[model samples]
Target: MNAPTMKTELMDAIKYDEPFRAHAIYYAIQQGYVQIDDPYNGLPADMDYDAIKKMQHANILQMCTVKIFTIPFGQGMHAIYLANCENDARAKHFTLYRQHAQRIQNASRRMDVSLYCEETGTHEVIRETKRRAAEFPWYVGVVGW
Candidate 1:
């Protein structure tokens, strides 16, 4: 969608508490803001303090939208799955990962976004890999498109 139209829709969606609008807000920030160099961190920075504040506000708005739309469903699914996997450690890990996945899904409201990162499997494979690597350290590999 065009920038103005997308911004208007995003503002309206934010008013109604729609999480998917975070994607639009993200796009708007990327489109309208300037990136600057950070002096201390030696990294790219945001020179416009006002724009940064606006972006942060948009992010908070998106988070609120996610809380409103997805928290209940996320809690329900977490409860159900955790109950089902009550005794199995691996299953518990999977369940926690599922919860994290739900949070990411809630944040982005996109199944594709949820699937994009290996980090989304935080409580399961990612945690397991770290846990097992204390002595017999090894890398867990992932291939993504």
Candidate 2:
């Protein structure tokens, strides 16, 4: 399906308060973004910015778009399954590397490095990577076409 249709469907899901399913569609389409708490998934009730940021930093923010299941209750209650990708060797490597980099005690002395290593003078590469990362992340098996 096209992006516009997908986006509309996502918005509709959220507007209807179908929380988890909404996020699943969003992550399936928009990478690096997700709803804060999905009751169907058993997330903490007190989710806040700090919690969300923690998830983002750990790269665990995206929902599972490849597969999803939802059970709707007549009174707007629902159970949802947003199945995210399983961690593989590459993801583990990057996660560890990011953790090691973030451990520097000096506040201003940390060097910035991206997992995909587009750290230098190539604006085009950066832009392309950003596009792919957001529109079709490699982990989703949608990139490199």
Candidate 3:
């Protein structure tokens, strides 16, 4: 499948897990993987920034480095693994994965905007956000490919 198709599949998988979708969307926005189209929507957008931030933090903790005190996954377990090993390997791997995940989150957020704004008369904001999201590889190359 092409990139856009892959992105949509990923996003659909994420949406199937509702909690994960919320966490991912918030994380994406916080990390600047996605930019808000217009901040001047007259009324505050539906997002609860504080709640989203908390969710993002929790999601990161769940997916990234395990607490040092925790036991490591045993051999033959299907734990997520990083391929390349370099100095600061764990940190680097988490960073890269987070970045990519955030992009997917951002795209999902844009999809939400597209779905909701029409009813709210925020078409301008929707249009702009869609345009920007489409520029991202996750959206343009992978989402609908």
Candidate 4:
């Protein structure tokens, strides 16, 4: 198939597996694979630095990653035509479809996404400590992406 279609299929497959998706998302965020809007850039003059920083960090947990691959197959042959194998199903399909073909070429792109999860438990202790300091019902916000 075409690049866009292939990407969607691959990303959808990844999304079908929740654990993998979560890991990918966390990894992407830690690596800064996604970019968040600069809250301070267009903020009103009255807004202070702390508010801008909080806004920026609040959205930094969002993550996205794109993977692209090139496949060479015969004209009119698509990946769906290939049989799915137990081992490396997607790779098997690609290899079968792209056999000694020179003219027809295609590329696949996949984007993976992950949203923030407050109950991740990684920073609960620190969050609780900060909340205690505030002497109110609050949790420390996510600090590092």
- Highest-TM-score candidate: 1
Candidate 2: regions farther than 4 A off: 1-4, 32-145
Better of 2 and 4 by lDDT: 2
Q: Please write out the lDDT profile of model 3 over residues 1-145, one tens digit for every residue.
A: 3333323533543544344454645454566555434232122245566766677567652432211111122352211222122223334334544432211111123333332243455443333343344322111111111
For candidate 3, the TM-score is 0.20
lDDT per model, in order? 0.35, 0.34, 0.34, 0.31
Residue range 4-88, candidate 1, lDDT tens digits: 4444555555554444444444444565542222112221244454554666666655343211012223323322111112233
Candidate 4's displacement at residue 84, Å, is 18
Per-model TM-score, in order, reads 0.21, 0.21, 0.20, 0.18
Q: TM-score ranking from best to worst?
A: 1, 2, 3, 4
The sequence of per-residue lDDT tens digits that candidate 2 reaches over residues 1-145 is: 4334555665665544444545455444444333423222323344354544554445453322322222232254322222223233234324433421211111111111122333453433222332344332132111111
Clashing pairs in 4: 7-109
List clashing residue pairs in candidate 2: none
Worst 10 residues of 4 by lDDT: 104-113
Worst window of 10 by summed lDDT in candidate 1: 78-87
For model 3, what is the C-alpha lDDT against the true structure?
A: 0.34
TM-score of 4: 0.18
Q: How many residue pairs clash (N, CA or C atoms closer than 3 angstroms) in each of the candidate models, in the order given?
A: 1, 0, 11, 1
